[model samples]
Target: MVAQLETPILSSPCRVPYTVEGLLQVFTGSHRSFFTNVMAQALRIAGQGTPVLVVQFLKGGIGQGHEHPVRLGQNLDWIRCDLPRCIDTPQLDEAETKSLRDLWDYTKEVVKAGSYDLVVLDELSLAIKFGVISETEVLELLEQRPRHLDIILTGPEMPKAILDEADQITQIRRSHRP
Candidate 1:
């Protein structure tokens, strides 16, 4: 269920400035998994005036020819950075590493151009864990983000420093195993 805030401002038509800090606090209070929906609602409401950046960190199965139904309904621009292709996996050889790094570098350059309203670094946590991308690079990107842009980071095991600096942090814990 979605937790409703009682603040009058929340009801107002004005765009609400949601930070990572506020979202973390809210998550601590309720165990509801409605953050994505809530965020979508908030963005829908806020989109009245300013553009909303809805960054999504997805694991595998992104470019497997199946279109994402949920993402299709959204109104913002969608830019996907295929994690497996962008990063060096354990199975990758030396030649693959160079190719992956090249891809990563190219993608980062595009991201640095600041064209999209929302930039989704899909499965970035795993990329960082696997040493495909550097945490410092992400920090720099966040620091240099455009003033009007809203950044969202998703994936498993986000770094503490990143979480602390984020305006919001939501941890999705699963019960059933694959």
Candidate 2:
């Protein structure tokens, strides 16, 4: 379900002079949950010609890698691990581990280069929790990103350091269905 905006944003394909210098936001929730609104927001920004990068750390099974990126509206780039299957557990083969590391490295390099105005790191917490990437490195990346870049991180049970660094936090909860 989508949150009702006080005012609807009509996309007439115009450039928006973004006001904020940068923002760090976190969306934490249960495992296997879909962050539809986050994705929607990213698309909306990208549709307006703002650069958006969506990195899915744990999702794979699709054989996606840094070499191949799915571009949307010429402003959004989506990348996933180059693994044979979606990583759901900590146990990974040597090859699977290497692929994840590659994606992480690529993500950092591009982000440090200020390639995108908005970056959505999906399941990044899990990558840290699984020890594929260190939390300290993630914090350093967040700290070192371009000043005007807005970053959104989504996952379950985000590390305290990441949460503390967030400018805003949105926790999703499932309501009881009748």
Using TM-score, give the best candidate's number. 2
- TM-score against native, each model: 0.52, 0.87
* Per-model CA lDDT versus the true structure: 0.49, 0.87
Clashing pairs in 2: none
Best by lDDT: 2
lDDT string for model 2 (4-36, tens) is 123334575574444456889999987546578
Candidate 1: worst 10 consecutive residues by lDDT? 21-30
lDDT of 1 by residue, 73-176 (tens): 34444333334444334565565455446545654564567554444444556566777678898778677665444555555577766777776665666567
What C-alpha root-mean-square deviation, in Å, does candidate 2 show against the real structure? 6.4
Residue 66's lDDT in candidate 2: 81
Name model 2 segments beyond 4 Å from true: 1-19
